[model samples]
Target: MEPDEVDFAHTDAADRKRREKATELARFAWDRAISGAELLELPDDRLRKLARAAGANPPSTRETWTVVADLLDQKSAWAAANPDHPQASPAHADEKIMWVKRPIPPWT
Candidate 1:
């Protein structure tokens, strides 16, 4: 299938959302790896061990690096297209929400 074609494999909305989130995280990881993050700079053997611990199949060094490069390219293109936009920060489960109390509701 062409890269532009829709992927029917992820037809479910939740699955698509999960895949999008995973891609974002992967891009962030790649950014850290290229920005002198010691953990991300670990050798291939160590990285493979870490992947195994996370219950993920370890990719070859070439494949991993290639993906990082592709993600970086995609990010760069997005930044170019939206020069004023800021990239979103990762969401936290413990984040707090503020509620506003109005004297009257709009319906009234």
Candidate 2:
């Protein structure tokens, strides 16, 4: 194995390890969110705050709300499908407030 090949192998292994760690963290977060441990009904401001705290570049306020709303809708659908499952009942399953904004027309 040449020196360059050894360096490349080390870099590849490090990158793979980082990716595995990220995947594990994501899976943990997902499980918590689905189990209702992590609240998903956060308003835009709170969402932004959380994102900033996590060192993440959050989307725009409108986009944040849209994504949360969509996730809630999916959770509700899952709950409806799995009525007997305990994790199916999300925190915002009963929320009726609209979250999506109307799209602007190109001609406007």
What does candidate 1's lDDT look like per residue over 76-96, in tens digits?
567568767655321231221
Model 2: per-residue Cα lDDT over 11-106, one tens digit each:
777556444443333233334343222335445675565445434555443433344445545565776899899776433423212222234689
Best by lDDT: 1
| Residue 63 accuracy (lDDT) in model 1 | 42
lDDT of 1 at 12: 84
TM-score of each prediction: 0.34, 0.35
Candidate 1 residue spans exceeding 4 A from truth: 1-25, 30-57, 88-108
lDDT of 2 at 5: 62
Candidate 1 — worst ten consecutive residues by lDDT sum?
Answer: 93-102
